[model samples]
Target: MGDGHSQVAQKDKYVAIIDQDKVTDEVRNIALRYDPLNRAGRREGFHVTENGELHIDDEAVIEEHKIVANRIPNDAIKIVRLPAERGELVHQYGENGFRLYELPAPVKGTVGLLGRNGIGKSTALRILGGTLKPNLGAVSDEPDWDTVIREFRGTAVQNYLEKLRDGGVSTAYKPQQVDRIPDRYDGTVRELLIVRDERNLRDKAIERLNLEHIADAFVDDISGGELQRVAIAATLVADVDAYLLDEPSSYLDVGQRLSVARTLEEFVEDKMVLVVDHDLVTLDVVSDDFHAFFGDPAGFGVVSRPLSARRGINQFLEGNLRDENVRIRDTPIDFLRPSARQEMDGIPILEFPALTKKFQSFSLGVESGTIFGKEILGIFGRNGLGKTTFAKLLAGALEPDEGRVDADINISYKPQYLDSSFDGTVVELFAGQVDVYTRAFETEIQQPFDLEPLFDLVVGELSGGELQRVSIALALARDADIYLLDEPSAYLDVEQRMSFAATLRQFVNRNGAPCLIIDHDLLLLDYVSDRAMVFEGESGVSGVGRSPQSVRKGINRFLKIVDVTFRKDPNTGRPRANKPGSQKDREQKASGNYYAV
Candidate 1:
């Protein structure tokens, strides 16, 4: 008992007892005594060092417990481990020479990065794209491959770097800011795609993405959804060994997103693909595996090792990293039941009578609909389907050619694409509404969306995700009877979208304010809506907005028209897009139960 070897013998005795399946309290206590480090971190296993030092088997936690790698290869490469940092910090603690994050290399199949806004998913993608060579804790200069490779050696990343260093891997990256696509290109969609057609897959990509109709449309004249598809097509048609797509699902409807994902899946068969996405359901379907980016937004990020898509998403939702033994969030996110069980009998808060609007290039017809108090109405359709037009009409931002919206109730509208004309900070945008900075609003909006740290940033300088959150929060802060949010889920990562959806739902229920949410992510709609309004018609030409119906009915009708079906996932109860021509798709279509659960 006096010597280390004697203590090791005592530990061995308990190990023998545990091995024999007699895990009594005394034996467990003995195991913990000799293996305190491992016991503290143990979820289901043990890590014993050569010198009989027992520690957590997790690479990230072990790395944290020890000194940073001094000589690169000689010390272990902290790969496949997630972060243990808290979600928010007043300032970035990693600016002076330390890494805000270290990510594991992507595996062969399609890999994904999942986290909230400002979490450095884009940064990780840039690193993988070879645009930003990692400094690897070197402050003065970007580390050369020799230094990088030596540090990354003994991991899959070492081989990736080797291939990159040798020019064996060619990368084509579709950036996150597709909104800027217009600034660089001044041509029709077809012209752009043709120019990017290095692989001669223009025709095939166009057909797969259903871009034939918009082929002749000008790049600058197109909507966000159109730009998103074109960006994907351009990236896909480029000949490359590695493909990096950031937020491919943004502005895409469920069907278009699935099509894009399917194409990427097919193309990745013999290639390396990395995707960063915010929609959990779409990310689940598109990615074979995922690496979670965890930490403060724009502060620092650490990526986890590759996990099966399902586990990665679930872990993100639970805010727990089993391997790293850390909880990034204070509470776990829970998926609601498949259906809304309670019926609202409250009086109508707002009603817009049948409305018709005519445009130079398009026309819209919106059927009369009523929103009851405490209701969340989801609007689902393809892009440019007049959903936004209808919301504008109701908000008095636009006038209907025919009927009129109720003038009694006040409406707060968050536009689909946020334009920052404001010359002040986010906090200033809410100067008159001081409650937004208060603790009461923090629990509902600021905290969940991680907006406090971003309060001082100029409105125009905010990132896409930050802008989207601020826009939604601003709309919510207004004293109005109803909130009209167009694509509120845009730019949000999986966690942010889930958190925002919960926040919106809570806001509506608690404040007795009805909300009309128009978004392309069917999963978000399903999660948030009490009823849904389906928009149908030709894109960029005309659209017909049907009256709001029960969430299930409206979604079913929309899915049926899109020729895709959704089934509830057994694990999470969230809607999942069935593969085209799969048995579920066929059965659901044949049974006339699209979106049936």
Candidate 2:
């Protein structure tokens, strides 16, 4: 009873609202069944393939029956769109079958992008920063900015692109992988940062980012944490209209992360900044709003509309977009409450007395502590506060000047720095010591760690995240009495990190082997640890490691040193840092309860 011009959908809701100028042929063709006009005229003898490619059985034969049986019902459009709400199409980019659906261009303040690795977060940032041109989902043809701006007419992003095209805007991008900066630029940190000082704020940048200690050090000789800060400082000194910072807090400890956040808050006085980070607590602190991403990793991504940082983080944790009426995940990711964790049931497996380690300029002293079997003890402090040194001492990789670990224990350690010098493949790397084909390894390490695809890849050819996964899996697979992981979550995506946490919890429960994790990510520590071993003292001068204690007390000890308080999200049980000077922060500090309910 209808013509081929329009189609009405739903019992009460009429959703035939596609504007002609905005729809690309590629996108339109993919959802052609939903278009009444296309549906009526598409009775030709052709078969639409799954990848939307057209194939002819024979050049001379035309069979209308071929099209009859190869049709997708119009209702499947719901599944194609998934969780992305159709509001406005600002930008589209595609490459190698991966598409960045809708991306929002920021004008002012900080906008945080949160999602899994290999999604379109970095691609979106590159496109917005003008480092990469968008193909409008049409990668076969050359990109045309006029067409792009025309298609986005009357939208907020249209004017932004026009400004960019006219050189009315400028951008500075801090890449996600700061470890590669040395390959691109070398020399002293001060020398490199001084040249990037478009605003002549070199010293100011160093002071603000806490790069004063490494200012004169060679870029290639500095630590990962130092490289991260130096990258931020380089961007900070640049005089640009917009700042795109990717993973600014990756290698930083909790104190350094908070300091970096405060620096970012001050730097965004009147400029726009877009940040991509996996640390939820730091992201929450630095961002005023968020653009939550939902998609299959490495396949495609769809970004939601602008949302308040609070609401965005909560909805992402809940795995649903209420406004879009879509489920991004099959189930919500829950953070276990302190009460939900298993009690400390038995005696400590590894015991150590007061120990001291002395370096040329820095020294560390530790009080007596014991790590309980089947319990995860989290080591926390600033970057240079001897967390890694302590782990090395415990693993017997380094000698202590004074006391020692009381009992002999077999230790399997994943160091803070991952070595990519192995000449053989990942399978060959673990060929003899551990079996990678066992059922236990499959469930605990292979599947959760996403290592199946990495079996054939040479160890030296792996990226940071891939190498981290391989290192973590190899360390966990070995037969040892204790597992010590240093910054194991580094370079992992949000989902990967969560999966690793869950796997560790399960591994401990099944094997009864304890893990001592040294990390800077407060959220990860809070999520995975049952006991806390807090390290405190002056950054490079001296460090003191307190005895292992309850998770609440350990968190409180570190939070007090950082001069902040955290409250668990009521819905997800995830810890969220309270804003400094906020009423909640003041209340927690007054009550001496730095880790609030």
Which candidate wins on lDDT? 2
Give the TM-score comparing model 1 with the true structure, all chains together.
Answer: 0.79
* TM per candidate: 0.79, 0.83
RMSD of each: 11.6, 7.7
Error of 2 at 482 (Å): 1.0
* lDDT score for residue 502 of model 1: 72
Error in Å for residue 425 of model 1: 2.0
Please give the lDDT score for candidate 1.
Answer: 0.72
What would the per-residue lDDT of candidate 1 be over residues 92-132, giving only the tens digit for each residue? Answer: 12212114345546677888778877666776666677776
Which pairs of residues have clashing backbones in candidate 2? none
